[model samples]
Target: MLKLVQLYVYDLSNGLARQLSLQLTGKQIDGIWHTSVVVFGREIFYGQGISITHPGQSHHGNPLRMVDVGQTDIDEETFEEYLTEMRQHYTADKYHLLDFNCNSFTNDVVGFLTGGSIPDWIKDLPSDFLSTPFGAALRPTIDNMFRRPIPGAVSTPATIQPTPQSARAAINASPDPALASTLLQSVASQATLGPSSMAPPSQSTSTVAAPVHICTNPTSFHNTLKTHRAVVAFFTSATCGPCRMIEPLFDQLAHEKTEAAKLAGGIAFAKIDMGVGMGGMVGSEYGVRVTPTFIFFLDGIKKHEMKGANRAELTSQVNMLLFEAYPPHPHSKVTIPALEKVSTNPILFTQVPKLDIVTTKLCSFVDSASRPIPNSQTIKHTLSSEFAGYLRGQFSSNGKAVRSSATPQMLTKWTETTKTLVGHLPPSQLFPLVDMWRLAILDNVVSSWCATAAGNMTDPIQILIVKALSTLRSSEAPSTMRNYILTTLRLLSNTFSDLTLAHHVLSPSGKRSSVTSLVITTLLHEDASVRTAASSLAFNMAAAIQKVRIEQMRAMNGSVSGLDEDGEWEIELVSAVLEAIRNEVQNEDIVHRLTASLAFLLRLSPVYESQLAPLLEVLQAKETLQSKLEKGGCGEQGVQNNDIRSLIAQVAESLLVHMAWDNTRGGGIQHKTYRDCEQCTL
Candidate 1:
């Protein structure tokens, strides 16, 4: 009781017809037939008919010319030629009339022909077309054709059933189900099989876990290891605050996740302590200027990477990879739909929710230093307390208790809000907020907080706060506050001097006293590290001053014969400072500062040897110089006016002796023999 099936072959050709003949009868068909019936079991299958006629002819012209066809038309003679050519090109046994398209047609045709009773051809088709040898080879080619509907066509029963299965099989075979799902989900609703149901069981097991080996150095991991299925490497540093925040998350992931734990077996997780291990060489190798960079490897080969402190982003990427490796069960009751196929008008995906939290935290730390406090007392408080109340609102300790965190963005909002708050306060109270920021530079915790804040604040006022503290000039600040100021200023100035207000302060006359005080204090500071910082700052200041002077001199060169009086005054000031420095060069702390400063000066202005000669003389004459160096009882411990006056006379005498030699013209007693007589010592 086999049923007759209508086979609608599309874009049919002689190749398809011959393939069908061989598949059905195991014998090659020799000639073309316009309409034909093939019998398999007790069923009869009819292919679509084709008729060829002369051009411009009505239904009947010279006689209806019958052409070879399965579903589409072909000329009778052309069909015969095609058969001959295929027979010549392909061996008799190798040639088949049916490729994948015809084979698909056969399955449906057999099913219909048998009246829903499975035909021999239907029974012969592979149970799992995706895994079958023939299905694997031909499934992709068939799938592509079925995705787009044929133009100017209506769906027929035969076309509807076969097309979708082929298309779905191709999608299921892809390596990345997420990517494949993304592509296939659009048409998935129309599909008989839902997305979740199609996924194989292997895709369900991948979950990211803790890393195995914590390599202090990644290069060592690369050097030591030979083969690994996957490797996760983290680049971090101890001083990087963001790294500190993210390290716990990375540790937690490595410790708990099965995949990360077994990474050593097939995957390996490694870490690079950029501060100590690689000397930051690995960072350069990986183009990681920032901390908390994660790199993923497969078979010890790098495949993916991300940088930043967002734990969720890292986790999302890890989860995506894990699911890809171990897909959800295809037959599972719980299923996730495949992603939709792409369209020109694609739907945009919103970013995950957790990113906002991460951004808030990062922004909070960046602007922490510049944020104005409510009062002076707040400065003495611990950082956790200053922002504790704020933290209570932003985070949840156990998903049940919501807390606020003083993030940079929140702080910025607070700053804006506080402007209104300040309006209610007396004008006298306004300056105290600025003072708090100044005080923050001293307390290590506050200083670190400020440093973190500097990284986040976008508002000009917040930026200015960081800039001011960074460039704080010793002379512009009150003397009582100067010591604390220098220490805080040193902390910032040593590392971020280029961005600090200290550089700008050195450029102006009004601020020069502050600059001078800073330099002097640095040179006299008891701490070796502080002395070093002061010396460095002094060098930077001197270089800046020299540059300004050079530019001014260049501008005035042809216009004036003598040096500008203002310029001369600046030089004199510099010389006086130099003299003061030279007088104190014997103090061990000051000596290092002076030597470093002098070296910087020598490098900066080598041509000013004559101008610098006196300072050099004092330095060179250390033993006598120290003995003669008198403290002016002026609270400052260095040379005073009397010391300067005596040194100048000694210099003048030296000049006079030289002048006398020149006047003598190589002979006779010098008119004035300048000598340091015992009376001068008195």
Candidate 2:
């Protein structure tokens, strides 16, 4: 069920007293100083304080007025967690009248939960007022005075209104009609969510993998030929030094062609390395045993061939053939490096205990009688000893080994149960469901499924999870739910990147899973938690890609350039992360994750060498610009004591170390993790 939102506005005083205060304070807006967001039916309120208080009981008494701010789909548990996280930044001890205050907190909470911020007039009022000369002059005293709440109000929700709204009318709908109309014209959207966020759960799911044809499968290859695209076969030998030498370039072309072929149908490359089994079959089929040979096929007909290491000739022929057979694509448009062949190793998922005892106990934790997810309440109604014993049976390890009770079917049912309760259940209750699923994946369920089911022609783990995600992604996900999803995606990608081989990552259907798409979307999500998780996932992906690429390069000797593609996902991942960080300047929480992501991404060279140095130069320029603005805006204190300035300095320092490492390579950063800057002691 969608929840209701209420914006509680408090006025400092009424009539001319309001005008007098603004006059003395030297601001256009009257003394509507404090705001609290009340989740009406839930009896929950969230506002800034030294800490969060439950039941919406605290603040400047009952608000003078409550404005309906539309509805939000966030469950109570989700909102509670959101409020909890908000308090970490806007804590009671940290509150400042001008900077971190009650009103600012409300706007953030309202914006995150509902997607629209509080009224623009109210949201901007404080910032605008503080920017004024008169308001600026008195800021220091106000900051000191309101650093902490008054002793009495800190503990108990104040029943008394701290200020009055009588003077509010004088300035609002006041004696002056013109001023009143302008100030009272509420600035808000029809709804904060975009049309897409409101889009109903889609019946459509892109579970089908993309296709690529292999050499042994002439049927698949024959079918691919129907597209009239050019296919290049690079026949190489294990003993041939030159074959290894040109292999990276050929592989690079293959990766680029794979992408290019998708949009414009230009070309595709298939590795026919005699050292690998498939290459021998192709070599024999073509009556060619020579290493370093390039065979081009267009419309199922062999059109051309290149022998020896005439690199220029091979490249030129393939280029011409591809252009003629398929539309040309400037894949060099985003030139980085190309990916190696997919690894044949199965991405074995790690496994763990089901811990049935804990899960069964949690079944009764929520007040089920109140029923959060309307259609689902059976688990809440029945606390049967029999069910508890059954759950316990799944976890019993007594002297003997406990037999596994967790299966794909069981997990699927559990997921369906949890998902149905998502909007209906509070976030606190919902997180456990996500955790349970994650553990199931960790306990080798994920790996087992990927091996047996994911690559299968039929639906199994991938389809089931994709359908579940479809349900999860269909609505305006509450912050907690989004947080859970982001965390899950991060975990999944991190594991997949680590354990899954390149071949295993590819589906038999000739396409890649939509997992990357999921991560990218969340990386750019409106929610900061999701973005943070996505950034962290990128870091893991880059590391995994680099590890595998390095391993492959090592096996190939010095033939391929030391650089294979810098992790398949890093280039795009870093680009997205950088864009988000650049856009969300006010969100201080994102900086740490962005800096961490950049640190890891910078570990990949050529790409890192190309990108990091210029980034340092840009960071230096930004620092200089900010230093100038702050000095110009509010004197030395503004320049010296600013949060953004401080954060900027830290980010620059972090990037500086990376640039230094980039220039020096790994010599300076050895044994130095991100936490202990290469220059700093561990």
Candidate 3:
């Protein structure tokens, strides 16, 4: 008999998610979804891992929505066997609220029974929540909660295989708490992960072998070897008992080293089954005479071979290979407290001016223009009425609730209208319009809509910001239109609100050349306000870069080689910031922000002579920032310099104290190579 499968969806937040999701996360989330499969007269759910009870009678009560998910022909006995296999993966200790939860299990079950997936709105709760600034900030805190140990009998499940007692005892006995913490966190984090934390269970199975590459043919094996700097090939026969015994350990090692391999070029773990198609040929070519042979290949050359399935030797050899290929930085041994103290959050300019006043000022500027600018009356009305109403509904005031989010149709209309107005308005009069957009884009909904590419593959937000920046090209722009320039800089800073837009702006895809020019020019502007705005923009970009570096370093266990390959603007940004630091004798606020930007850029960068160190050396960064530490520099002549001076000194110390220039070579940092660094040795 084909049994009916229904999906029961519960709202973990009751109705509070709908009531306050927009206010908190800038998106309308109906609920924190919890789902289960109702089949065979039972409700099967995952939390403390796959539990069953009578229908509509789990700890979560009745579901808000019951989805009829077709029928399944598989009998209860076979289904139970499937559940038994699943128990190995979905143990109580492996359960995570966000990463691997009740919904993930049901999605997998639904896929198995019906060969169809659940609704995106149901499965996409984590991603949709994470898209907002508030949601992104809350993720680490949430993950940390699930990282704590489960209580009582909840800690153990029959199907779950415990980590080897030897490995656990070694890690616990280690004197270095940091090492133990790192190893423990890696295991804990991976336990709840089903492939990526974001992917659905059907798309991403719970397997430590997610990163491993299986090579069935010699062509495929050679391709894997060619691409990776390091390759570990497991030569195994289908009937070999030792190979079966050691297979799980190899998968675990692959999972552990996956992130490091990605950072340090590429490392691949390949399994070649001698009994499978063309696998015997591969083994013969590698001179593998034994069934359970393991070969380590570096740069396409066979480096070492081990005969037996010795787990300790295999683990030690792989670690040694990774260290040889991608060594840790020498600077990792040095302590830089100041750099560690720097926050990586992007600085945004979200100050909202009164919509009424801003609209009035815009109208006055257009109406009072010496010559009538194009689209003046139409844009004025659009700003004062249509856009004003939209902004009012989007932004909450005096604790009043924001209106329901704008629909796709409304957003499309606004996008078309804004694009038209931007094209028609004179470049000189574009700031007020751009300023309006600056406020609008602060609303995450509007920001997402604007960042999206239209049919022609052009982002409206990118175009609008670029147009505002182009006005700076005019010779008289700095003095004649300081408000326009400052407003544009502020808009650029706010672009960081949407990570997609911020990434494009920082990447080669974003008209980075124009932005670089704006930063270089505005940082030298005579007006302190203009310089301050530019400094904020610079800091936002630096924060984004620093954020990436920090994440990559963490993934690699604190051994990143350099900035991302796309960071072409690093040199220009460093030079421009250093030059600005030298010229700015007023505005301590600008000086402080600029120094922070410089510090973030320099910290944890490649210690090689060819990289940023040469530029910092040529520019004499230490001396330029050192001058600001003296009394009555970088601010008003009479102001007390204690606080600002102390801050500047810290930045200078963190950045410059370790830098040593080769005086004989004219202008380059003292060169350091990976091979000579003892700290990098495994």
Per-model CA lDDT versus the true structure: 0.36, 0.45, 0.66
The lDDT of model 1 is 0.36
Candidate 1 lDDT over residue span 1-682, tens digit each: 3222332222122333243322211223322221211332111111111112223132211212322123313333543443332222122111112221223223322322232222333222322222222233334443332332244444221122333554443333222223333423322222111122221211111121213443333334553244444456788776789887887777666654432222223334566666643326666777877778887765555667898988898877655544433222111111112101111121111112232343343234333434544542332232234433333333324566554423334344444433432333322223333332333333222222232221112222234333333434434434444444444334334322321233224423123444455455445554545455565556555544444333433332211111112333344444544554554433433433333333323322423323444454444433333433445212245444453434433422322111112246436533322233222211
260 in model 1: Cα distance from truth in Å? 58
Order the candidates by TM-score, highest first — what do you get? 3, 2, 1
Model 1: how far is 660 from its true place, Å?
12
Better of 2 and 3 by TM-score: 3
| True-vs-predicted CA distance for residue 507, candidate 3, Å | 1.8
Q: Write the per-residue lDDT of candidate 3 for residues 1-682, one digit (tens) a residue.
A: 8889999888777676686554344457788788889888888887655677788876677789999979989888867866765665555544655656676677667755665556778867876766554444444444444542333323222122343443332222222223433533443333232212222222222332445665545755776687688999999886899998898889888877865544434688888877654567899998899979989989999999988889999999988877766666555554545556656676677666788887787678667766656666776777687777777776648557456554444555555656665565565666666777777767666654443332222344556656655666655645567777788888888878877557546655344666777888889989988899999999988888777766667766565664234344677788899999898887888887888888777766654335676666677887788888665565545224466566577666545543343344425534443332233322
Model 2: per-residue Cα lDDT over 1-682, one tens digit each: 8778888776534333265433232334555556667773433332323233343444344566777777888787866665554443333343444444555556556655566666766655655654433333333434333333343433211111221243232222112234432332211110011122222221211111112223322222343354445777777665899986886666555555454443233355655446432335557777776888888888778988788887778768866775555321111111121112222232322333354544554565445625554434554432223323333444455646444544444443453454454535544445444544444444333333333222222223343335336645666555545645654654454345324222233322211345555555666677766666665555455455455434433332211122223334445555565655555443444543454444444433334445544564655433532342343422443334344445445434544443333324556643322332433332
Best by lDDT: 3
Better of 1 and 2 by TM-score: 2
lDDT score, candidate 2: 0.45
Candidate 3 lDDT: 0.66
Instruction: Give the winner by lDDT: 2 or 3.
Output: 3
